[model samples]
Structure formats: structure tokens, C-alpha cells
Target chain A: MSKTVEIRWHGRGGQGAKTAALLLADVAFKTGKYVQGFPEYGPERMGAPITAYNRISDQPLTVHSNIYEPDYVVVVDETLLESIDVTNGLKADGAIIINSQRPKEELLPLLNGYQGGVYVLDAREISIRALGKNFPNSPMLAATVAVSGVMGREDFLGEMRQSFQHKFAKKPEVIDGNMMALELAFNQVGC
Target chain B: MAIRERLSGNEAVAYAIKQINPDVMPAFPITPSTEIPQYVANYIANGEIDTEFIHVESEHSAMSATLGASAAGARALTATSSCGMALMWEELYVAASDRLPIVLALVNRALTGPININADHSDSMGARDSGWIQIYAESNQEVYDNFLQAFPIAEHKDVMLPVMICQDGFITSHGVENILLVEDDKVKEFVGEYEPEHYLLHPTEKMAVGPYAVSNYYMETKRAQRQAMLNAKQVILDMAAKFEQMTGRKYGFFEEYRMEDAEYAIVIIGSAAGTCKAAIEEIRATTGKKVGLLKIRVFRPFPEEEIAQALSHVKAVAIMDRSEMFAGSCGPLGAEVRAALFQAKSQAEVVNYFYGLGGRDITVQDFMQVYDNLENIANTHVVTGMYDYIGLRER
Candidate 1:
């Protein structure tokens, strides 16, 4: 409420929700905002549902507890909605964004009575077309930024490009594909 | 010229080690603390530092290798968590009694029974009397700053002892936060060159470190080490002051948050202190109750006098311990604080609460309950003479 944006991501261990949260923190930090990004470690294994959290703000943060009331919840894997309470402790004014091919209205019942905005995006198609793989991390991040307005779509694109350049220096195609997927996902989110 | 960065407690410590560029680092991996060695190994691989990264097989070997290097006069470090710390239990005393001045980046983990990889003070608290200069941190920034200060304190001519720069296992170690790092040049200069006066590998000086002493010499040697540790109290303060001037982040034996003119206060350590501060703020704002906190930063030397004086005027106090001492009287922090009070002759009603064992969550609400008990004690001058656990389920 004090200009801090808390977001939680629900996804499998290898699906990059944790990566998305950290990338957002790094990019948001580059944009001159205070940020915190960390994953709750359980018995981590591939395909096991894992949770990652973020707190981004203009001022420094002091509270270090797990985010029980998140401003935005991103379900990086739509299947997580069935097994996990994705909307647990969401703020009344918060929004839940799901990465799915389904319509926003169709996923409304899966919200567990959350009276907030529901947004969905066809992240798989966008990822496959842009990156030639099904890694939806960057797209989901872009979609999260788009729906939450935590970061401007244009600013995220620019920052993501700069970060990806360093992370994928040997493979320019990977950088280009991630950038393209982010932009397409930014456009694809429907509130 | 300090640089602003965002890093977790583990990364911050690793970055400090990167800047210090010690002579050797022999390490093994453990939960929550594994990231520290992993990061340092990466730095060495990238040639950011030329410090020897010895990939030891176990925590015991890690300590042995560290002592082996430090005795040879090469500045060394290693890291471990809960069980790993326990495995190195025997060597902890050797590192101290040998007066090797090794700086250990200990990420505090819970000593297992049911087995836990979470945050607790049991690991470090168990070694509080192991002659290591133990310092606890409440945040990532403190962890970084403390790691940078450790070498100076331990290597001081007066206090030739090992130092453990400890932060909570996953609570601070894994939690990312914004931090200001000192300029690399400034840190390197402050830690300075480690030119040992007498070491096993000295070219001209002949000396044997860590030789078994008979009863005739052991007590005197221990007396000298004890004096050195006592001298460390001032050395630690001096280093903290110097660190403050360089980085503008002042540190002390303890942090008394809003303790002035308070009738009810809670003393705690590490990450849970962050939550307690929030609860204190809420109690102050919503209930008009003046609640304060005394968060312990340096645990080994146990700033008894300063802590006693700080809580002298408070009406009722709650000392929260993340690890249970199981010592019939009280937990470590509680027993120490009670002793400090007895010495100071303060009449403040004090109670002990053992919480967050095995990394059970100690939330703002949990602290709120402690505050309520403090208030009740404040009114009636009575306390429930019972050991308490925060949020522990009774079967």
C-alpha cells in the first residue's frame, strides 16, 4: 500500500516462475526501484510446484515475511490452479493472471472466489512461435507487468533486451526470441 | 564511493569474500549456505579472485583444510549449515584454541532431531562458548558488513581468534534485499594485508601451531586466549566504528529499536526481529502501547553490560530465542539476559520465549502475543513461569 508492489508466482520447479520473479527484480532494480526476489525452497525437483515471491517499490522495504497478501498473483503454469490455491491471500484490489489458452471468462471459476480482475494469455503459442520452445517465463513476466502495471510494457521490453543480451551473449537468437515472446505476450494479455 | 546493489545474505557474504580475496577457501556444500561456496567457486572460475578454492569432501575436511591453510599463514574461509556445523564441532574448538584467526562464513542452520534445513540459532548458539568471536546479523546488509569486519577483528594483534559471521539460514541467507557495498579499494584497505607474525610456513620463523599442551601449559595458553577474546570486545567496537565511518552503516553489539521511555520490550535476533519491529509499530500505533525491541547483533561476546543498561528501565521484557537451550533455567539469550539483569540489579520483569525452532514461522501476530504478555506483566508485575513456544502445536 505504501507504493510497494508484492507479487507471487505459482509454477513448477523448472518452469521459470522463480526466474521470472528474479528477472523482474533485476530489471526493476535497473529501473531504479527497490526490489526483492527469492524462491521458497522445498524438496525441489522437476515438475514439482514451487513458489517464488517479489517485492518491488520506490522506497526500501523492511518487512521480510512471506507475502501473505500479494497485489498480483501470476500462475505461470495454468495447471497449478487446480493443485494450488493461486489466489491465496490476494488483496481485494489485486489481479490474478493465468498463462493459458482459455478465455479470461473461462478461468473465472478457478479463482476460488477472488473478487478481483482475471486476466489470461495464450503463453504457449507465443513462446513456441517466438523462441522455438515452450519456455513461457519471459512471456508470463511480460503479461504480469502488462496487467499489474508494475512496469511499463515498453520499459520492460527495453530492460529485458539489455539483460538478455548479457545472459545469452553466445546465442543472439535466444535473446531475440525472448524479446519477441515478451512483446507478443504483452499484447496478448486480456483483462 | 560505495556501490548500491541488491543481494541476499549469502550473495552479500560471497561478494565480501570476493573483495577480500583471501588466500584460500576450502569448502563443502550444505542447504541455504551452499550458495556462498557456489558463488565463490564461480568467482574463482572467472578469475575474479585467485584465492585457492579447495572442494573438500565433508564439513570436517573443510575445517581441517581451513585450519591447515590458516596455520600455514594463508588467510582462509569456509561455510556450513546445521548438520555440517555439527560435523565440524570438534574442529571449532581447535580453530579457536589454536588461535588461527580463520574467518568462517557460517550460515546458521537448525541442529536436527526430526531433521530440518531451515533457519534457527541452534547451530551457532551451540558454539557460542567454543571461543569463536560469534556475531549475528539481522539483515543481508549486516551480513555483508560483518563479513568484511571479521578479518580485522580476528586478526587484531590483541585478539588472535577465529570469527563466525552468522546470519539466519534461509531467512536472511536466501531472502534478497537492497544493500550498499563498500568500494572494493576501501574494503581491501580496511581488511588490510594478513602478514602473520609467526606461522608454520614462515620462511625464517620456526613455530609449531596447534601442538598439544600438557596441563602445565594448557591453562596459561587458554588464559591468554581468554584475555584475547575479552580484548576482542573493544576490538569489535573499534572495527564497527571504523566500518561506520567508511560505509555510513553504524553497527553495535546490539540494536535497541525504539527502547527509550518504553515500559514493554522484546529482545530478539536475526530475521524474526524484522517481524517484531512491525508488530511493535502496530502495537504503538493501534493500541497506543509503547513496545520496543533490543535485537542482538553480537552474540559471542554477549555485550552483557550494554544490554543490561539498555533494558534497565523497561517494566517488562520478553527475550525471544530461535533455539531452545534446554538448560533447565532458560534459553541461552534468556539466561544471559537474566544474568546481565542480575549483575545490573535491574528489577525489570523478564520472561523467555523459545520460538521458530526448525524454522517454524514466527509472524507479526506471534510477536503481538508476546507483546500482550509483556503488557500484562507490565500491569501486574507477574509473569507465567513457564517455558513458551511461539506457534508450536501441542499434541
Candidate 2:
């Protein structure tokens, strides 16, 4: 019953957008908040566009419907902007974060005149610099937390570090890289 | 203390399966429900439980192997969706008729034709008369809790029938959410042991299952099956009460939300009920309308009298169905609920709606519109468009 933060993620099938949404739900739940993470399912293909959603609240969530008017929208794959209306029902006061190095001015036109704040994170650059890979989900997740202020910066970093440690327990070397990517993305997301 | 965790509906059921550690699980893979067997198989491989895992060729063999295990006095279960269930149709009835206490984890999906892999009630609705004690869930937590109770309800002395615990495919089945899980010891103790009174493997006595009843005894066997179903109503309540004592979560044949003094109401089942609840909360907060919802948890042993009593006070009701019966009148739930009201001699105005077919999203706004229609009907005492579809494209 409390105020819920609704988020929608747009990405390709193999992009880990769904994984990022679920990871957000995991961290939020660890903070003692009720959370839901689900992806809009379709025929599975490598390059097909897919959508995922998240709901975080202080109280239990009763609604099982897809988010129409989202408080925040994260376009995990910037190319999806041309094919999908990622901001179809986005709240004007809320924000849209895109993982593009093309600058916010170029992406704004594709959003159908969305008047809310637009945030751009050069996720590829950040990921390559921090982790030496093209994994944009880690940076995009951090950018979302940084832009939305869902949790404090320090708290989000701490949670991500712990999560990475657990996820990469066998391969402990990758934990630091993922954490570095998150911190760099958290600090570098620009309006 | 209940362990706080987060899991998808399939994982939750698999976790419960790990806790109960049934004797045998014969399964074949199907979307939405495939994760269940996959997880259970992982547990077996990891030595988490000693449950026998049977990988069969098809769903028919999966269910046939399950019934074989149950008749041989091993606690048995299986998981399937859509056409897999249709393939198991004959075994479903045999499990009930032969009095085998089998538990089936059913991920409710749309039956094929257009070849869709989405959530709907058609798969389970089509099996309404297959003699299984059907229980539905609106969330992951409910599905987990319902699975824990399925064995107790199905194996009770007076109600030795198969149980189908159904959740919407790709909705609760795939959605991850927060859940409180009972302790492993508590679940094991609650589910208890499945000791059938008669079994084929008995050392001193011999028993035969699936016997061909002659024309003289066929009707009596059916009558006995119906009696078991009738007895299940009370058994379901008793088991729910016991489960509440252990976990502090109350369950019943159905859940009534804000129905005390409501003039407009909606009757629904499965995950959509959660959406309806959200809409009801908004309606009460904004316009102060007395809107309410009746979410059915037990569908097979239809709680006709109790549902009638709950809806008797409402002026107008919208009964929503997620599957089409194509009977030209209403869907499966609509037909049963209308008949229940008519039998109870209630004068409430009722409308049946078909919605959410083939994974079409049903939002709170759609429910708000249904409530608005209910208000119109209650005030004017005239019913317009008694049978209709929600979220349908019309010319």
C-alpha cells in the first residue's frame, strides 16, 4: 500500500536487462523492502527486443500487472529506441536513463518529446574501462540507482559489492571489476 | 521462525518439494513448468534429497509413471503446462478414480491452437471435471503455501483425490518476489508421511488398481468419487486451519477483500485477483465507492453456498474469466457462479467477462472500468452487455 517505485527495462534478448531488473529486486529486498521483478516473455531469439519490470515498495505489492506509467525507464540497449516507444507511458516528472554515448540531446528526440529529466551513461566506455568487457547491465543498474536515488550511493555500492562477491565466489577476481564498473557508472551518469 | 526469502513460483514449489522430499517424481519438460523438474533434478544430483527422479519420453508417460508410483505406495508428483496437461488428461481422471493421492504442480497456460505460450485458465478450466481437487494462487507466496497443503488435502482419508496446484504461467511462475518459507522441519512434519491403506506392494495383502467396473458398479464408483469431492470442502478447510496454526497464514476456499458492505463487486481467480485488489483499494481511497472482490482459491470442489452468501449482499457483480468456453453464454467460472447464485435464490445482477486470454495484460484501469459498469448496473437496475470481453478490439 505504500508508494511504490515502478521501473521498466528495455533491451535485446541476450542483453541481461532482465537479469539487471532481477538483481535490482534482489538488492532492494535485502534492504527489507518488498520487491517484484518480472520480464515480458516472448518467443526467444538472440536479437529480439524484450521488456522487463520491477516494483519496489515499503509494503507488499498486490498488483501483478505490467507497469504502464513508470517512475523510471532504463533502456539497456540504446538501439531499441528506434524500434520501440520506450517512453510510451512514462511519467513526465520521472526520468528516462539511456545507455548511449551519443549524448542526451540526440536521444531526447527519439523519446517522443518526453519532458522529464534524461540521463545518459556511456556504459560501453565505462564497462570497457572498468571491467574490460561489454557488459552494460552492471553500469546501467548503477546509473538507475544513481539517477533515481532509490538508495544511498554508499549503500548501493556496498550491496553491489556483496552481491558480486556472492555471485562470483569461485571467480573472485571478477568481483572487483564489476564493483568498479558500478562505482564508475554511479558517479559518471550525466543529465 | 519462517525464513524470509525471494523466489519465483516455480522455484518456490521446487523448494517446497525439496522440503517435503516426496518419494518419486516422474516428469517431462514444458515451458513455465519445466523449471520445477529441472530444479528438483538438480537437488537430486546434489544429494539434497533422495527422491527418485524419472525422466520420461512425454507428459503422458510422465503422468502414467506417477500414477504407477502412487499405486505402488510411493508418494508421487509431476509438473506440466497446456498441452502437456491435455496429454495427461486420461491419467488425471484415473488418478482420482483409483483413489491415488498424487500431487500435480500445474503452471496454467493457454491451450494451443494459435500456438501461444502464455498464461491463461484454459488448460485447468478444461480439466475442471477431471476429478482433481483444483486450488489456484494469486501470487508466488500463495502457490508455495498451496503446494505445501496439496498433499495433506489429497491424502486425507475422506478425500483421497488428486490435487492440482495451479498458478498463471509466466506470471507467478516466472516472476520473482519476496516470500516467507516455513522451516524445513516444519514443512516435513506438516506434510507428514503418505501411508496408503491399501497398496499393490503390500507384503501380506494384494490390491488391484484401475479395475474395470462393470455396468452395475460403474455408476457407484462415480458416485463415490463425487462424494470424495464433496468431502474435500471440509478437508480443505481443516487442512487450512492446521496450516494456519503452523505458519500463521490463513487460507480458505476463497478470499474476500473489502466485501463487508460493498454494493459493487468483481469475482475472479488466479493472479488477476491481485490486480483487482489493487483497483479496489484505489476505488475505496479515491471515490469512496463500496467496491470489493471475491478471489476463488478452490475451483474444483466449487464452494457454491459460501460464494453465494459472500456475493448475496452486493447489488451488481462482474465475474471475470481468463479462458473462453465458446458456449456463447459465458466462460467456465461464469457458468458455475451463475448457477450457484441461481440455486441460492440470490437476486444480485451478474455479468460474465472474458479477459486476459493468450497472455494479454489486464491492468488496474481495466478493473476500474468494470467497477464503473457495476456501479451503473447497481444504480439503474438495468444490465447492458451482460456477456462481454475485456481488452478486446471491436469494430
Candidate 3:
């Protein structure tokens, strides 16, 4: 109740990391709170190391910028951690949410001093099982909501469903599949 | 109550931007101009202004995003220095030729190699041929005021060309001063919401921008851009007059400081104009040498008529340029001034004095040297390189 959560997302260009951040902001906003979403651009070519950000506050958010120090990080792809210092600016209470096939012990070096929380879910597995492809952005977002406690799980899921229904309104199958992936990853994170 | 505040030129630009209330800004920071974007971003973050600050990857993207936003019928802005501007040179030409009505506050910086981050007009002079209307500001006040005037001048239907307000880096961009600013609503009322006749990316309307200007119509498109530049002369004056009416402040193609009844005159541009103005006053008071100063504000549309008119009575004209165009026969602005004055029938013996190259400090004492040299000049057809340091080769 005393925590103000700031989330950072790590992914490559063309991987929908920015969309994930914006979606988190949208959901957080619907909860009658303040939020901002943005991305940092550097040589914005495909497969380049990219980061997007989100901040949710019960009060109005004034600062709008790329998140340098984040409270919780949602890792869309485990491999990005090798090239990225995911815990570079994480607070002591900060947490890591990774879509990894490896165990948490293997990720300890990457998460080093981050002792607040860790939510390990094979987002690739849930994404493959639900969407039949390795689109891990939604699963990572679900894992983020679980580990961060920025919004209630049910409200977050409802907002995610509403977003998909609007964005993929022309395709009902895609919307349903994305919602299922959200739920599967949410459950896998054990929130 | 008049509020006296001392602020850097970057602060002045930011102050003017707040007054202009441009809806969209896209920029990347480069030295000297870096503080400007930083300040603008700060304003956006603090809820002090409502605008879209597009954090772009490079100056090219910054200009491209500005063009996109401006074409979307939103007032757009951006700033850059040397290589940043160079990177956007191609897009900059397109933005101008297409008449996008974007205003850029350029902090003039030297081009890299020997990698100096100091002040110079070399970067801006390099882009002089890019078809955008360029205005050189002499002080922090002028930097703030010129940009406030730039919007209406650029967005005018008659002149939709992008406008650049160049202030010398560190000298003007970082130097602090106090100047008056008009009320916010005053500027808003003067410029008004941009109702563009031709815009891009409107869903309900149809318009073509930067279409293929192939062999057949390339010449015509270029002609249209040139005509737009030509049309800007009257538009600038009209806007200045309106600015005067609303704010009691007026600016023109050039500000003449004691140019009347002088045998010798020094015509300079940018912040150096202030130093020259002081030198003119000092020289007139002590030496009574009848020295005058003509500060060129409007660089593009060349102000040929006004320049010729200002120098018509003067016996000699020394054009001081802070940039060296190695490819050119003379300093960039010097060449342009010569071309402008050449039209005069007086044969007023114009000399190109390449001074202050690479941001070498040019003080009133330096202008005094040029003044003394101009008085002693027995030869009319010659160029003088002044204040040359030992390592620097004088051309």
C-alpha cells in the first residue's frame, strides 16, 4: 500500500514492447489513477535493444520520460537480459518478471541485488500455447500485473480484454486468444 | 510592472516557445542547442505547457517528425546545432520547399573535425541554400522576440516556408540577459490557430505533399518555392507591423544603428551585431569617425533592396562573416552582401572581411581594428582577414 510502482519493459524493436507499456498505462488509467507511457529511441532499427516505460500513481503524474530507474521490469524475451543490464537501475524493492525457460537461480546474477520480488513465468510457453506463436508481449504484461500489484488482477484482465476487443475488433479469434494468454500467464505467475 | 530577468539564450528560446504554444515539438539535443531542447522538454514534463514532445533518435528523425506534425495542421517546432542540422539538411530542404510552416531555433555551432563544440555560423551558412527563410538574432531579447514573430511570418498563407532563427552558440545560446516579453494571449491572438489551406494526413481531405517533382515539373516546384521565399518579404513586414500594434515592439529586415551620414560602415549579423553597435557608438563619440552599423536580421529573400538602400549613402561596406565557405570566393554572408550591394550604382567599394572564424572572440576592440583598417584602406578591391591567431592561416 506504501509502494508507488514504476515498470520498465525490455525488448527489441518491432517486438511490441512499446505497445505493452501503453496498454499497461491504459489499464492503470481506467482504475481512476494517473499514468504515463513512453519509449526510448536509439538507432531505432529492427532487433535493436529497446526499452519502454510506464508509471501508475493514485495522484496525477507530471513527469513524462523514459524510465531510467524502474520498480518492476517485465522481460519479454529472456535472451535480451544477456545484452541488457535489466537490473542496472532497479531499486532494492524492485522486482524482475522474466519469460524464461531457465530457473530463477540462473537469473540471480542478472537480478543481483533486487530483493523485493521475482515472478518467473514461461511467457513464451503461454504465448505459444494460447496464440500458437511466440508473441510474448501480452504474457509479459500479464506477468507484470501479477508481480507489480499496480492493479487488481481481475480489473487488469478486464482492461486487457477490452483493449484487445477494440484493437482486434475485426478479428474475434485473435482477441479471445490474447485474453486466454493473459489469463494463462497470470495464473502461471501464481498471483 | 516591468520584470527584469537575466536568462540564457536557451532560456529565452524556451520562454518564446511557451508564448508561441506550439502543439508539437520533435527534437534531439546537440551542443550549444542542447539546452534548448532540454528546457523545452522540461516545460512539457512539468505541465507548464501542453504539447507533444517527440523524443526522436536523431536530428533527421526530429525534422521528419516535425514535418509530419506540421503537415497534420499542428504548429510544430524543433532545434539543432551543427552536425545535427547537417544530418537533417536533406529533410530540411524538403520541409522548406514544401512550405511546412515549421519554426526552428538554431544554435549556431561550428562543424566537427578538430571536434570543437563552440560557436560559429559555419553550420547555418552551410544550410543557407536549403530554401528555408533564415533570420539571425543579435541578443537574448532578439532570440526570444524573433522566434515569437517567426510563427506568423512562416505560417502566413503567402509564405508557408519553414523559418530558422539562428543564435550563435555559447555566445547567444548560453549567454544570459534580461529582455521584455509580450503576454501569451498577445502572441496567440497575433498568430492564431493555423488553418492551413493545404495539409497532409487529414482523413477527410485530400492533398499531395512532396509529390514526384520529376523532370517535367521539378523546375515549376522549385519556382513555386522561390516565389514563396520572395512573397515572404512583405509578409514579414506585415507581421512585424501587427506585432508592433499588439506588443509595441517592431523588427524589420534590418535594424540600422547610426547608419545615416557615415563614410564608413560595418554590416554584421547575429550577436556580433551588438558588439559592432557598441563600437559604432564609441567610435562616433571619441574619434567622431562617422562610423555606422547595419545589423542584418533577415538573411533569406536576401533583403537586397533594404541592404542596398541602407548602404546607398555609405562610402565603404565591410561585411564581417563568422563562417568561412572554403568553396566560395569569400565568406558566405559577405558574398551575399556583395551580391546585394553590387546592384547599387554607387560603386560603394564593398570588402569581404573574414573575421571571427571558428568562434574566435570578436569584441568591440576587434571591430575597432576593422574600423581603423577600413579608414586606412587605400585599395578597394581586397579582402581582409582580421584578428588572425598564429596557428590560423589567413586566406
Candidate 4:
């Protein structure tokens, strides 16, 4: 458990929260770490709140259960903070990274007095400035990596660049936008 | 050298299918399992493998077409979950009785009554008596490995029965994890080719399949099927040995973790066994308790004697089931394991627990509590409750 890092994602359906979790796993795996990425699935519905999880460890992971006490919690959709307990069972020593433009003071109360270090990133701003669309998945993923220290910034960026090149091969321009979004988000989290 | 890759269980199984390049795959879409065929279809469309992909209207047709192809001396398979498997109920028996040796990639999910789509063993557990050789996986890697062995085990001359390779739906089927894949040429050589001795399309010999059997012949046919299942216990081990030699992973009828000197143990199947293993490690580390886990890999041949021998040293054992049998006493795994322990004349106090039914989550904490209960049971020698439920809410 000491070497393992668990993270949970809170997002609406189609927000790519699940995708972000998987990307984290993919990046972690590239660094030779064992990883698990999965979503708590339900009936398909648009804008419905969804949860996904990640377990990154140096040793091989055998546990298949949901993360009850995650070291970090990522809120992809800030509105989910009102409906879901985003900090439930979150470690106090760890932190919660939220994709919001709101000031920290406004969002802190919404966390039900969570004592964890709360880091805020304007993912919408970052994605819009970089990718010209509000695709928060990239920024949120980068923020989680920076906050959790699952991998160094250089390793994360290198792996993500290769993945984006492969994923967006047909549209070469989209790769730079995504990389920019990751960089903007990574630096904004102050890592 | 093994290829290091990350893939969901479905992807891993489909990758194996691509490597094996079976002759035919006739399948209909079902939740958690639809991705298996979808990936295969993508493979075929991309010219990666030339497997004949048949898009069927229903799971019934899926199984029927697969049976037809296999009987026609072609390697055939299909994938399904939950009600889709129920739809193929009739063909399940036909494939086994006719000895088609077809393989089925099953992602275990709950059957519909109230209508839910999540991970559970109700579907495969329902087909426990369908004459198919059932093998359950604890993770994506295990499912990939189990599927690689399915063809060799099913196609064995001594055990020519259909095999169902099962994994927890959405749990392993959808979750992405790190896995080591054997090289394609090695997989090709390992699975080899399916060459049936007798078939409907034989050039020289005339053959018939699924003919009407009277009561006298039917009984013997069933007995032969039983004998085939009994033979599978050995074939499974033999194939596992070969698989381990090719790769570095060792598999058996059941995996015994920390069981050598345990006073309390848990017998479980499927993905939750991984969670139980995590719990065992924590309990042993913190409390210095001798807790162990017996994760069953081969559920069909049951491995009765071996399981009893493995748990013989334990003072108490909790047999956990992810599916409810509605039999008033215990679930399917519990019943079979209790029977095995009984026949072996072991005095281990046993309690049956029904957990994770209908996609419910079983956490490590829940498992830790189960171990705590086992300790209490072993110490008191009084069974407060023999049949119980975990993660169940009280009214």
C-alpha cells in the first residue's frame, strides 16, 4: 500500500473521466508501473454522474475492488461536488484536484471541510486556450499526475506525446494542441 | 520473448483469437462480451486474421452456427453474457453432447429479471451443469491465459467437450491491466490446428451428428460425457504445464495462496479472489494471522480431491460464492466445495457466504471481516451462522 497510489475520478457521462483514468494507467504502465483503470459502469445516460478509478503501483496489482480510500480524487466536473461526496474516504495526507476556474475559497466549503490539499485548475480555460475546445480530460490527467507524483513530469509528457501522436495520427495538428493542454495544466497545478 | 502490453480481458481474449486464427466465429452482441467479437471483427476486416466472422441475429443462432461450423470440421467459437447465454441454453447442451469441442468466451454477468447490466457469475453459474468445461479467471491476464488453453483442452482426444472460458463482466472484461502476451508465432504453434478425426464433411467417410438417441444409448452418451469431464482434470493440468513452459505463468485447477500453514482459509472464484488475496496479505502482515486463499481456476472438473487436500490443514474455511443459487442453504460453489470436503472426511468448519450478486462490490475491508469471522469460528468451534451474506444491508 505504501508504494501504491490510488485515485478516483468524479465526472458526468461522456466527460472522459473514465478515459482520463485509463490514460493515467497507460502512462503509469509506460513507466514500468503496474496499473488498473476501470469505471463503475451503469446504463448509458448522457450527463449522468459517473465514477472511474485507477491503481498505480510498483508491484503487480491483484486487487480488483473499487478504491475505498484513494490517495487522490479528481473531480472532472466541478458540479459533481454538490451531488456526490468527492472526498469520501480520501486520504488527508493526499490531495484532491478539481477541474474548476472558481477560486479555492469558494470550492473548499463545497468539499465538506475536506482537510486534504485542494488544488484547482481551470481545465476549461487550459483546453480552450490550447485545443480550442473544452476537452478537460488532458488537463485533468496532467493535473492528477503532477499532484500525485505517480511519475515525473518529463516521463508523463513523453509518454502522453507518443500516445497522442498514435491516437491522433490522422490529424497531426491535434497532437500539439493536446500536448499544449497537458503542459498548461501541468504547470498550473504548480508541480 | 513475451510482449508487454495493456489490454482489457476482452481485448486479450480477442488477441488470442487472432493469434489462433480459428476457422469460424459466429456470435451475437451482448453486454460486457460484445467487445470480444467486435475486436475480432475489426481484426478480420483489417486482414489481420482470416477468421470467418458470422453476424448472427440472436445468441441462439450464434451457438447454432458455431456448432454447425465445428461439426463441419472447422474450429469455431462465440462470446456472450447473461441473458444471451440463456438464449443459447439449448445449444449449450447440444454442443457438449455432440462433442463439438467449440470454445465459448464468457464474460460473467447477472441474468435479467429486474434488468441489470453488471458483473456477476449468475450467468455462467447457471450453466454449471451444461456439460461445458468451465474455467474462471481472476484477472485479465488469467482470462487471456485461460482462453489460450481452452482450445487445447477442449480439442484433446480424451476430452472433446466444449469449453467456457469465463471472466467477471466489466470487472476484468472492461478493466485495463498490464499483461504479458506470448509471441504470435508461438501462440500459433501452441494452439496448433484443429483436426477432427470424424466430421460431416469427411471426404471418404459418411458421418451423422445429433441423431435421435433412445433411452439406452442416451444414458451411455451422458456417462461418456461425464468421463470426458473427469479426464479434463488431467488435460487441464497438462495444458497448463505447456502454457507455463511457453510463458512464465503457472496455472492449476485452483491457485493456493499462503495456504501451506494456514489455520483459516477462503475458497473463492473469479475476480473477487484477487480482492481476497489482497485482504489475506494485509491480515497476515498486520495481525500475523495464518490466513490463506484458494482461488478456483477450473470450476467444471471442480478439482474435488485436490481442493480438499489443499484445505485439509485449515481449521475453518469460508466458501465464498458470487452468485446466489436460491437453494435456501448455500450458493453453487459452496455446495460443491462442501461436498468435496465431506467426501474427503475433513473436519474443517465451513461457512457459506453469498457476496457480490447482481454487480455488488466486495471490498478488501469486507474480506478482512470475513477472515475475522473465520478466526472467531475456529476459536469458538461454534458456528453462529453457516449461511450468510456479505455487503448485504439490514432492514
lDDT per residue as tens, model 2, B1-395: 89999999999999999999999999996543459999999999999999999989889899999999999999999999989999998999899999899999999999888988899999999999999999999999999999999999999999999999999998999999999999999998999999888989999997789988999999999999999999999999999999999999999999999999999989999999999999999999999999999999999899999999999999999999999888868899999999999999988989999999999999999999999998888788887765898999886
Q: Per-residue lDDT for A16-119 in model 2, tens only?
A: 99999999999888888899999999998998999999999998998999999999999999999999999999999899999998967888889999999899
Tens-digit lDDT track of model 3 for B48-165: 8998899888898999999999888889999988888999988988898778999988988889776776677888888889999999888777788788889888988888999999
Report DockQ per prediction, comma-separated: 0.61, 0.90, 0.01, 0.91
Least well predicted 10-residue stretch by lDDT in candidate 1 chain B: B27-36
Tell me the deviation in Å of residue B188 in model 1: 1.2
| Candidate 3: residue pairs that collide | none
Q: Between candidates 1 and 2, name the one with more favorable TM-score.
A: 2
Docking category for candidate 1? medium
- Which docking class does model 4 fall in? high
Score candidate 2 by DockQ.
0.90
Of the pair 1 and 4, which is ahead by TM-score? 4
Q: For model 1, how does the per-residue alpha-carbon lDDT over A54-172 read when each residue is reduced to its tens digit?
A: 98998876666778889999998898888888898999898988889887777888888899888888889999999888988888998888887877767888888998898898988
- The residue pairs in collision within model 4 are none
lDDT of 4 at B69: 98
